[model samples]
Target: MEARTGREKQVYKKGSIRQVAGCVPVNKTTKKILLITRRKKKGGWMLPKGGWENDESEQEAAIRETYEEAGARGKVTSLIGVWDHNVINKKTGLPKATFSFFEMEVEKLEEKWPEMDERDRQWFAYEDALKVLIKPFMREVVEKCSLAPSNKRSKKEFSESNINKNLKDTWNLKFSAIVVFFAFLIWYLIKDNKFISILT
Candidate 1:
């Protein structure tokens, strides 16, 4: 006896899938993560990543994007994870995307590179980098990497809290300077007895 068939096959739309690759370049010795800022995005921050080329493998694409965006060349040590989520493409308004992330250790950092004008690269601690990341899932990935075992740990890692404190101190210093400048101006006028003359 043949059983009644009720199962249905799943079908994917043509040209609906997009592939991307990126890496998290971490300096374990310094406990710092490198990040890049896109020129078009203004204040937005992101990991170095891009779409795969037809002739390149996923890891190759990841390495190329890292170098292009951050001016850093390195080897992908391990596959962190493969993540997929919908993103509305600003140009096409489509929502199909996938990304493969890897753990990378920076080997050579060049003073000048292809994307020096298109992007700005900087280093931040795990927490501070997480704060500036534009994507939530990427933050998740960073958090996971921060917990992973490392062979070395540094004495000091840059912190956002420290940055805020430095800014506050700098403001106080500038304000103090201005106050002293006005105080000196008043003193000079009074010493020369010119203040009252000017008022008269």
Candidate 2:
């Protein structure tokens, strides 16, 4: 689907606050979040956000933005709260946009998305995400995102996360074992024959 680029259907709040919706797309474990690069790689990286359209609720708009900008589909719970910030001539000019950021548990990731050419997407550990976020409002969204696992993910996804984590741990253990074995072999080759007698 084509992303909505024009503000014709945008939802404005009060008189000047432009309503914007975005999401902190994350794995079921909430260990990492998905971020999208700025169109020109100017803002570094940011949560998938855009104008809240007139036809959709804040939540719907947020999820839509996640799919369009981050190429993620997932489940989001209630509001993670909202913040209001002013835009300063990077893209949307000087209008103030009121934002509602959701904590989304990503379920499906598409290889091709509407904004694929416009942006690049990646998953980052929560702490790393904070470092690349250029906007203060976006940082606030990360800070407010719940890190506690909800344990609400579908069994299949939850198992997948566990399996992935286990595999990583197993690899680390094997790597460490190899390093230790090589170190011992080197030490044996250099040590005096007296030290070898203890092991024999």
Highest lDDT against the true fold, candidate: 2
- Which tens-of-lDDT digit does each residue in 1-200 have in candidate 2? 68878989989865667898999888856489899999855559989998998889989999999999888999996577788685544555555777888888899999888989889888898779889987987887787776533333455687999999999999999999999998897788658674567658
CA lDDT scores, all candidates in order: 0.76, 0.83
TM-score of each: 0.62, 0.67
Q: How displaced is residue 161 in candidate 1, in Å?
A: 36
Stretches of candidate 2 exceeding 4 Å from the true structure: 86-95, 148-200
Residue 14 alpha-carbon offset, candidate 2, angstroms: 1.8
**Model 1, range 96-138, lDDT digits (tens) per residue?**
6778888889888889877787778898888798899998988
| Candidate with best TM-score | 2
Model 2 TM-score? 0.67
